[model samples]
Target: MGSATTHALAATSAALDAASGVDLDVATQLFTAARTLADSVQLRSALADGAAAPSARTAVINAVFAKEFAPSAVSLLNAAVEQRWSSDADLVAGIEELAVRAAVVADPSTDVEGELFWFSRIVADNPELELALGSRLGDASAKGTLVESLVDGKVSAATSLIISSIVRQPGERRVRAILTQALDIAARQRGRTVATVTTAHDLGASQIDRLRSALSARYRTDVSINVVIDAAVVGGLRVAIGDELIDASVSTRLADLRQRLAG
Candidate 1:
């Protein structure tokens, strides 16, 4: 979809090459195969995703990675498929991500904090610019121009080129989705979990902090809030902790009552 697919492998291979002790050629092929699998619609449709059955998913993983991948790659692919995210680009991203982690592990001297800081700062410093890149006005070269001007030689070669490739890909509004999933996977890799919350009312600063604290203590990690003001909610707050929802809103109760009366 993006011109970056071709570049992604090269760039990732180079970066992992620099990361020390990683076999760039293996990483390159791994990235390529995962990307190709993601590009296929017919196979994506047959995956029967989102279940706990690792065996059923393992068959597909074997089909894709058994022939081409190394043992580590096969294991990573199987885990992703078992997680029922095999068909999405995010799953592929997670696999490449494992390689990145391995590279970091292989080189304990790598400045992880510095790298993350640079990426975070770059993203923060150019919110408007990133938004525009995410929005399309056409001109592939111009999009590539933004990547070259903003990202080149700044971060990991793989990271920068991957961002660029996602941007230049035609009609693939998947960068944000992939990044979000990649971040979640990154967090899980680091033994942390993220709980996202939405609110109908403007939670007071203290209330927000308390909620975050409660969620952190309950789930044992920091939480990110997606606060929204929905006047239509009528009353109370709805808290989502992981996959569970605590709906304590008056509006919901009234609607339930209305349905009962009609019945």
Candidate 2:
């Protein structure tokens, strides 16, 4: 993230916070707008141009979206385009994040983070399914339909919408990675951080709770843990918290030992 994008995200997040009571369909509209911006390089560049007047950027937003989108959604888009984005990509990603955040706020009681995490796990475990979703040659609508069918009754409405949106327009990211990022975004929306723990086997409920508590204390904030079981881990655990990784797995140790012997 660039400096400009960091500032833009903060501004956009505040705008979404103010629009909490706005229609939930604002999320859908924003997602649509993101897809539009992504498909049009000229439009995206025009909107994110720092040299352009804020009013000029917003004028384009109004001319294109005001009539078609909900009033709240239009207002949010206008706010978004008014900010100085680092790049066209960041502008589009900021809009997408707002869409996800709005959906999360709309369904406050649902376990969206957990649902997304589990869905990512399912995708990670199934290479064929991941390839299908991540395949650029596949029809976007077909991918969206497939995601909707898989998550329909199993996930919250918010989770379903988020999954469908990301699946339909994956950009350059793989399916599972973006899903993991979405789950992290969902956790952040609730003022929590997610720590992914991969172990050779699943941990017990008490063990999970203790780990969560430990991390929460260390980070000075609420923490959520998503446990992934992988036999390839061989033994021990791998924990990922944000950009940091703590690897204590036997496999890593063996790799280090081998490197030392070779050296």
Candidate 3:
């Protein structure tokens, strides 16, 4: 990340921490504001331009979004725009990150990271569903409705809002990728790390707890595990935490052996 983007995120994080009584409503409003900023080139430029006075940028934000968003959301956005951004795109991404953080802050007890990971896996398992969500020609509203129908009661309200918004506005990436990013952001908001673990079979509750404990000890922070059962893994497990991967799966070992033998 650029210095500007990093600074902007830091400022926004502070704003979120200071805001009281934040809830899913604040998150939804922030997400809506993000979409609006993303859709308008002029607005994004005005807000993200570092050369412009911070007061001027905040004024622009108030003029456009003051009435549309809750007081907390407006305050957060104003603080975000007051910081410098690397680019217009970064400004939009920063807003999205704040939205995800708002959701995490609202309901810290919910397992949002796990929900996002499971939802992404569900989309990955169904090619048609994935295509429908990622298709550029599809209607945005219809895609959002489909997401809501699938997850409304099954997941937390925050998770549903995050999924629906991403499906409606995935930009240039696949639905699964966007969901994964959201999951990571939510985990970070809680000062935890997310480990994506793939195994040949579903792990028992005791086994998962043990793994979580071990990973937490290794990383020195709380670890959230998102399990994906794949028979192709063929025993053992593949664990990914951030950019680090610990591959103990039988398939990976066999592939490495085969490569070494060929060489």
Candidate 4:
């Protein structure tokens, strides 16, 4: 993230934290507004141009979205436009992140992070599906319809909307990468970091709890674990928290041993 995007995100998060009565409705409005911005180059440029006066940007937001969005949603957009962004696309990403954050804040019971991770894994496991969703030749509306059919009843409305929005228009990013970014944003909204753990076998509840606790202690914040069972790991497990990887899997050890023997 560029400095401008970083600052904008911080400010938006603070606004979310301080707001009251934010719900899924607000998220839906934000998503719609984001889609509108993504589809219009002129509008995106108008709002994201750092050279434009902040007041002018705010006026544009009010003029375009005043009647379309709720007060809270419009207020959020107004705040977003006031900050400088690296690019128009970054502004779109910021809005997407805000939508996901709203979903997380609206309903504590829903597991948006887990839903996003599992969907990404599903795409990873199926080559045809990945190609279908990521192919530039495919129709955007068709891809969106596919997303809705697959996840509508299975996941929360918030999750479904977020997935649909990204797959329909993933600017310069793969579907899986976008899903992962959404997951990270969802985790951060709750003051937690996501730890993706891959093991050779499925872990039991107690084991998962213990691991979560251990990771939380290490990271000094709550950790959300998304477990993936992969037989290729052979044994043990691998843990990825952000860019840092803790590789204790048997396959990794064997690879290291082979390197030492060759030396």
Clash count (model 3, backbone only): 0
In lDDT terms, which candidate is top?
3
Which residue runs does candidate 4 get wrong by more than 4 Å? none
Candidate 3 residue-wise lDDT, 54-114, digit = tens = 9999999899988778889999999999999999999999999899999989988899998
Compared with the true structure, all predictions reach lDDT values of 0.54, 0.91, 0.92, 0.90
Sorted on lDDT, highest at the top, how do the candidates line up? 3, 2, 4, 1
Runs of candidate 1 with Cα error greater than 4 angstroms are: 1-91, 99-179
lDDT tens digits, residue span 1-263, model 4: 89989999999989888887788889888888888899999999999999999999999999999987889998898889999999999998898788889888887888889999989998999889888898878888798889999887889887887788778777778888988999999999988899999999999999999999999999899999999999999999999999999999999999999999999
Candidate 2: which stretches are off by over 4 Å?
254-263
lDDT of 2 by residue, 141-188 (tens): 899899999987899888998999988889899998899888988899
The numbered model that scores best in TM-score is 3
TM-scores of the candidates are 0.43, 0.94, 0.97, 0.95
Ranking by TM-score: 3, 4, 2, 1
